[model samples]
Target chain A: MKQIFRTIAMIFVLCLAASPSFSQTGKTETYPPIDSDALEQFGGPEGVRNWVESLFYYIMLDNRINHVFREFGNIERQIYLNTQLLQLVLGGNEVEYQGASMAAAHADLGITLTQFNAVVEAAYNACERIQLTYEACNLMIAGLAPYKHAIVTR
Target chain B: MEEAKRAKFPVSKGAALVVAMLASGLSQAGWYDSGKVLATGGVSMIDGAGGGGITPWATITGYGTKEGINGDLHYTYAPLANYTLHSLGAAVGFWDRFELSYTSSALTTGSTFDTVGLVADTLGGVTGSLAGTPINTGIEPFNTTIEMESIGAKVRVFGEAIYDSDNLIPQIAIGGFYKNNKNEDLLKTLKADKAKDWEAYISATKIFFPINTLINITARYTAANQTGLVGFGGPDGSDKEIRPEISLAYLLRKDTVIGIEWAQHGDNLEGESVEIAGLDLTGLQPTLEALGLGNVSGTLTQHESDWYDVFVAFFPNKNLSITMAYAMLGNITITPDQHGFYMSLQASF
Candidate 1:
């Protein structure tokens, strides 16, 4: 019994180890066409605006990244640009984000991964405040997850 | 900007409390950052390794990021049908790259000794009547505990488990544990070759974000019998071999997850023949079998089974987590199908 188990286990381990051994390198500047379903879940562009506003409130309250936001200044402009970007990402083709690219925007911010995750947490709490479905929140998180590489310069 | 400072956020008290407790108070020290996302740092495994209930993964133990440190303490209790297992441990993660851990584990074998005593009495009666001489198997029925201490270390080799979400490559790590059993005399009676040994393993863990699923695979090489509680190696089949463990977890929510794991064990004492005070019992196997008592060698043979568990973990906040599981630990020495409920509580800082 031991020999048989060893043989089967060895085969299984070898297969898992051999597959997908290479890392995903490089980056893409293009975003996928807006997810209309997700936009609908967020109740279109107006709902997205409210969600971003709620997110700003949490961000200011969060001690981890609030100081960075305070240092950046221009709270109103930050909210406008973020709302537009979120709308476009959630499939609102009616508006275009006239802001800097994610990497360029945060390049000089010295933002650490910890601070980046803090922003994500703030966004999650905002979703809960707005009563977004669990699936909707996950979709939003998955949509925003890839931006971590560009934003976390530190 | 000044207006934003007085924005009246109206956030939940729970959120405020978690943020105040986890993010504040330690920034000046530049340590205990608790920077990792919630649930990213897994709970401590049975052997104090950072992973699930029984299997270790590639992820580090605490919420520390690459620039900071974090640590936690855990206690686990598992009561099987014939025995109970208890473990308490502490682990510290250094910059989320390296980990050091220590665990003390105990197994209560009081009930198991009753069955062992029965076997010894039956074997002694048969041998004494057949050979016209009394033989002592040296099996005592007294209740005693098997205790062990382990020190473990792990280093993440490459890849990222939580970040780099757009990848198929998993985070890989290498680790080892040095375990020493406290019961030296009991192990010698059980014919264990050694009381202490080291085990090594390589683990690969990946999180598939789209599915909210995590898969971790580990291959461990060791000769420790029953995870070194009963001792290392043995007089029977003592060979250090690679055993595979796998875990699959699905994130039910951001702070909740359910998972299952399977870990194989080395059967180091299978087919061992009994010896009573330097007297070989192989010659009595046929007679014992004819008497409907089975082979005499079988009395001493130990067959171990793989371990499996289905567990659910809830992260109430970053600082605390509670995990409950149904653990199926197949056989411990002569006991069969030793399975029961297991639970663990961990507090991180």
Candidate 2:
């Protein structure tokens, strides 16, 4: 009987250990700042494309490609993609192109440019809160260099 | 060992009971309202319209300016010389955004001996055999009865079509139903081969409104595949069938609609011998068995019946509506004409 009790207790312990917990954890993680030096390196229209490519890679690593593409059930991802796209363009050279306005460009692409701008500002503010590094800022800048004109012109 | 093997997966009697409850529940609920009398209509909801109401139509209608959720209730009854059928269904929706539904049906079919004396005489044939009489005994009366129930959930992927902003866009919906047919015990009692099967269906709807208030139309097609009915046949040799329907609704008021619909099943059309590679039968028996009915066989022929419904709906608010409808079956092969009436009240946030 004692052995049977021990066996039942062990089985109960194993079952409890295998169960998944549904409680929420209170700890929150902060994101790093934008890489401004990389932004400067990739400044201007020539830098915009590279910046978009880097942002694309970051988003992919983050498992947010569908959000960027505006596919099914990715509204939050779409906002993030639009914001990053705008930050790369505005943060680059101040040359303006003769296409649609940034807002219109975003609209044409099935997103709201105002929303994108808001997201960019929020991201920048968040970076300050975390005291982001200059290297990180520069990396983001460099990535934006390739499509600077496309961003500003739109 | 054989009994143990049978017990291991012996068709779940509990699951069968649950299915029976669901089937009866849905049929009695009667909430889905299809809009057309015989054809399909464009898929869209004008403030009280429901998805079940959308029938197939050739032209696009009800593009834009149509919004609202519609709820429906439906029931069907068939009384045949050999069997009886009772079905109930109910459905609710929100701005055509989401839908939840349930249906249940009970069928009592096969031969019933009205007199005990006749049954005793039939039994006497067996006793006579013991007496060494060479008289041939006639076959005893055999009958089959079946009951099935199912539940489903659906969502609208898109609200409006891209190219035609005025029309209700195509909606993609997916749902599954659990059916329980009660004839398995009868099949076992008769020592006949049978199995209980599950069935599923998927469909799309497009609604069109031409000339605004005068005519609203919709077209819809559904495909169903299922298996497992004791004594009749198994899923291995079951066939799939498509149902197409059309509906037309006339707007009596901004918040009111009156419509008619016609629907047909492709599996058991008139005059078609209901048989598969490994099974043989005539009409409703095989179809019901394919649909998860165990031992229920009826006088109804396979696919020999079509359905018609007339319905009215009233919407008092954006999220609430009430509907009333009546349906009848025509060209029935084995039953007295079937008739049904239903009323449903629904709300969604």
Best DockQ among the predictions, by candidate number: 1
* Candidate 1 TM-score over all chains jointly: 0.80
Q: What is the DockQ of candidate 2?
A: 0.01
Candidate 1, CAPRI quality class derived from DockQ: incorrect
lDDT of 1: 0.75
List ranges where model 2 is wrong by over 4 Å: A1-154, B1-50, B53-98, B107-146, B159-169, B174-176, B185-210, B213-236, B267-303, B316-322, B331-333, B339-349
Indicate the residue-level lDDT of B107 in model 1.
82
How well is each residue in B1-349 modelled by candidate 2, as lDDT tens digits?
7334433542344335434543443365333222211112222221112333323222222111113333444444445444455556554443335544445555565553212123224334543456654322112344445555434445544322211212233343433334444555433322223333333333344332221122323322222211122222323343434455555565454456677866653332334322322223333354445545434333323333555767776766434555566756543333445465645444422
Relative to the real complex, the DockQ score for model 1 comes to 0.20
Cα lDDT tens digits for candidate 2, A37-103: 4444334444444344444444444332335444433545444554444443334333323333444
Q: Cα miss at B19, model 2 (Å)?
A: 16
* DockQ of each two-chain model: 0.20, 0.01
- Highest lDDT scorer: 1
lDDT of 2: 0.38
